[model samples]
Target: MELDKMDENEWRYHGEGNKSLVVSHVQLSIVLRLLKYPAEDSENPPQTVEQAFRQVQNIVDFSSNVMSCLLGEKFVHSGEVVKLPLEFVRQLSIKVQHQRPAWRCDKVMDIYSGCALCLPNLTSPTLHQPTHTPTLCIEIKPKCGFLPYSKHVSQDIKTKVCRFCMHQHYKVAMGTWKRRSRYCPLDLFSGNRQRMHFAIRQLIDEPQNNLKIFKGGRCIFSSMDGIEDSMDLNSLLHHLRPYFQYGNNRINSHMTSKALLTDFIQVVVNALLSAGGGDGGVGTDRRGEGRSFCEASLFNKERSRHGSQGSPSDSVLYRVRQTQMLDTLDIEGLYPLYRRVEQHLQDFPKERTRLQMDGPYNEAFLEKLHKCPSEDDGSLEYAVSKVHQYRVAMTAKDSQIMVALVPSCEEEEDDEGLPGQRQHRDFLSSRPPAFSYSVSILDLDPKPFDNIPRQLRLDQNIVSCYLRSSCALP
Candidate 1:
């Protein structure tokens, strides 16, 4: 299965085979080259080749354990769906530092733990006592997993309050309030502060809305992770066996895992952006837009085969650098209160997230892709041309992290001199138990959808019978 972010120029695929020997050799070679004896324009290698090799080996072993934990519940299962929780865009580095990894592995650091990465140092016992920075690869697991069911919404007092708190909470904590009365956690009983607390008080007064908070939902099931819940369709029909099913019956076997995973990942990426107003505008109803899977991708067919090519040599196709994309935007440079990101998500009614994927996985697209020559071949040109039509490439230069008010049972004491004073207990804090945020993919788990039951629901007799009536095919 191929996954591509044309905008970021990144791609990934799935593989299920054991190649430890080959992988280890490749890792060793990389280490040797990095720490090789000879010096170029750069400084001398920190360690000898043999030392580097051992470190690399240690890294590989550590990575395996980390991967296993990230996979979590899916580790032992086959055809496992994988999603890297950390969203930082730096390349994996082999730390030439003298100290070993604090945990099971060698001295290599958890990429998130580095002070250079711009993560906040939460001073709590939960943090490592020495550094007070998080040691584990902290990732946010999506509470609801996918988008909750909401299509149209008005900007209620609750939403505005949530946004105001989310956008301003950090500033208040840092003693950098812009609009002083907007939301002062200290003046909890004051007039304007009381008005700002209206939404919070409303939830506290009403029991129903309070219930949804624990369930990881709010007044509206906002479109998140790219599912324009505006899908008015009763149910999604997952077709198993298309008429042109290719060799080895690729549909029955491979279809269940890779294909679903491809769409799932794309949906999530979009949802995350939309939740944070990365869509740049309001969400659109994709189905209402009269869009259909070109080759019946998820619908179980091939992409329309048109012999065409897009700009194969076009260097700047989706040219937004990682540093620029808000998804991976550096946090250290960001200011908590003055952070200028897309605000007022409730302004849009329908989900504004755009669809990135063209169609689900199909052999024809793959075969045509594989047949393409190194340069501009007819097959490649055709695939690229069609891919262009999936979704209009959109970029936002000023996107910021999405944070909203969350309901929590905890509260921070007003005492500033206390040990936990820096750690705010209010609902506005981004740190968890009481905040809803769509900042980065770090907050999401890459768990695969259960397709076994969906596949079993498919029967050849039912498919053929339905096809005969619908398409009049003999």
Candidate 2:
């Protein structure tokens, strides 16, 4: 889609006549800057795709707390709670063939998400009603891993191992083909001829061996800079252009992709709602509840050295750490963040009232509250409590990670002509590749300095239950 000229910070888009949407785009790397310690452009972000998803999930969830705070007493009058759908429309330089060969757009919309809305919890006054319309919309851009740098490995002897593929490269003395593994006989030797020794060197040379791997580390992505942003867009376009077409015979809409993306947006919104009531990023425990700093890695590395040795009363470092050990909800550190988002909304051209929240269960409870003009039956208090429960509850039931299995291999002759090649072969080529995807709703970002496992457990239970459930997910 083409954008109209406005200013450096945002792109003003048009839908119907006199109606427009102003979108401010940011990079994923920029979001990393929000972390305790952001990585430099020269260095890679320490986390993998899955880990990054969890980090984003945490941030989205924590942002929900701000939404809850914004809702405040408004929940009773306005009868709503605001929710953020992490469906951030990111601008990237993905290749798209135009009427001419190379017309470049300063930005193109991707599958990334980060949109927030304060509406009714699927209930209360009822969202999109006669009185409530969250007209203001602001986009927060985080510099996530959009385009990654591809490592150029030399084909020399030392860099024999390729990150893209794992083709076996060993032969026995009798000309028999076999991979050199720990079980191989040739690995028993030492020095230059040792098979196991070479493998060990190769292992050490691989990038990101130190980082934690998920699911038995089968989906290792830290070393491999993943397929590029353009590749993802291109794949999406390729999937869309078969039947559906726009003007001039060019396919414009892909129904399957559009539906899946919509579902992905729900995943993010639910994640944020989940974060609000659970712990508010600082649970009952005082540890990790104090100050929230932008620097986590570099700053901590230096301060931690002398922080403990100094006296708590006299030493500045000790005082800082000691203060940090207390409750974070007691601090005003999150005030600026909340204010900034509101300021952006206020500056927008639309008229927006106080923020609110929304979701399935929240909506039902709000409906009950709206009907009960009094609390004589005690249902009003119970309904309000249910709203809170819905806020902190997990969202995995709505957003689930899916596994799509596609055929990646076909039967082929072993041209080398091994003895009974035609009838029954090694079957390596026929092996199917499992579907590995980055769930729109990743893991939770735990409260800083909090050693408690509660948040982690909540996040894990959501995913585990989804996997175990018979319900279908998009």
Candidate 3:
């Protein structure tokens, strides 16, 4: 029985999103992601069993095949899907109830789900690190990095303000969020060193849902909303001292915790900057002199268009910006195209099969997706192809970045036998601590195609509220 079924007690709640619940295994370096549905409609849920199965399959395939192509394979993890015993899943859900956020309790676990995705515990230190070494993991959800360039966007504000910033007003008005977050996606995605550091600090100040910090696979700091006993900045800094301290420079009572906190933020900034390119060094540090989003947007545009030699095209920000360009039409224009494609599918039954989720996850289908319309040919196929690419690009825009840092052991660094082990240093402070780190993008789940209209409505609402309130930044 033990071999056939998982032990519920071995797993604890990790975190949850709108669609899923994750549980980390206590004894193993792996996690199980199970699907969830609204509890109110459990008796008659909107999604059928077949649809749910297809949804799960689409996530695995899209992450492994589609997103992995767009956002490099080294950064994305395509976990295997496995069947879990029904009783085990039910027991597991019950065990994790108390840990879930109060606001997220509207949705309950899908106990009927036989399958769950098994992914490597990203918060855990990798094999190269010693067992006792502490791992500090920071997860950042940098939403919608670029300002809309679509001519069809009727609102001029959309061109000036980013989606994340505008949505903050809407979120606040709706009482979903108590206040607007100061962290701007444009800053982090600016590819500017100082700006990125500023963005990280803003997230630390008011994390909301944008940032989460974990120590040794246990969450140390995140938003305090409905989450019990979460650590504040001071407590977080105290806990982080050991990682920032160097040889013989122990983080004793004499050492200022403020310095260690600043150094730690620099380490994260360096990891994010460097992870996009070749081994060791951070990417190009384009300085915006701490300009406003509108001002920085212009600078960023200039930098992206006429980037110097060795622009680090492989950098993660570059990849994201390129993908964001797919939505040049923006939702205002894309919605009409989506509707036309939907109408066309209704007219032609055979064409509907092409958009169905029943197809096997493979390269052939990906090739078909890749072969998009080169231009606006004003055909049904062109519209269909455009909408498809837009949805795929949305996944990239909403993805989360994980920066995992582990304190380097002297013996491990001295092992000259190992090739390609480029150690990164904290360049922000004098006598910086040396640490090994890795950056990865997670939550590459494919967005539903049907959300196009909903997004259009939300975009309109956000702009209207932000404008009506006269909250446009100078």
Top candidate on lDDT is: 3
Clash totals for all models, in order? 15, 34, 0
lDDT of 2 by residue, 1-474 (tens): 112331223221211001111122221100111121121321443555455445444444433432222222111111111122222233211211121111112222222322211212111111111212211111111111011111221122212212111112212212222322212111111111122223222322332211111111112221222423222433433432332232333334434555433332222222212221121232211222211111111123243333222121211111222322221211122223233433544586242222222222233433432343232243323333322322332221111111111111233223332242111111112111111111112111223312123433432343334333313434
Summing lDDT over every window of 10 consecutive residues in candidate 1, give the lowest-scoring window. 14-23
Candidate 1 residue-wise lDDT, 1-474, digit = tens? 111221111211100011101001111111011111222312444454444344433333222322212222111111112122223212323322211112212222222321111112111112111222111111111111111111211222211122223323333444443332222111111111222133222222221211111111111111111223211111111221121123354435444433442332222222222323121223222211111111111111222122112111111111111211211111111111111211211353131122112222233323332343333233424333222211111111211111222222234333232353112222222211222222222111111112212322332222333334335524
Best by TM-score: 3
Task: Compose the digit string of candidate 3's lDDT tens values, residues 1-474.
Answer: 242667988889898888889999887778888888898876665576667677678789988988887777767787877778888987988899988888889998887756678887877636246546768899998888777766788988877777887787788989987877878788787666666767788898889889999888888888854555464887888778767666455634445776776788888876776653344343443332232254323234454343322214556666666665667688998998988887886798687667643344467556656777777788876786677678777988888888777766555554332343222222222255756676677787878767889988888898899787655555
Task: Give lDDT for model 1.
Answer: 0.21
Which residue runs of candidate 2 sit more than 4 Å off their true CA positions? 1-356, 359-378, 395-474
RMSD of each: 26.3, 27.7, 4.5
Ranking by lDDT: 3, 2, 1
Candidate 3: segments with Cα more than 4 A from true spot = 1-3, 44-49, 247-253, 276-292, 295-311, 356-361, 414-431, 471-474
The regions of model 1 sitting more than 4 angstroms off are 1-115, 120-435, 441-474
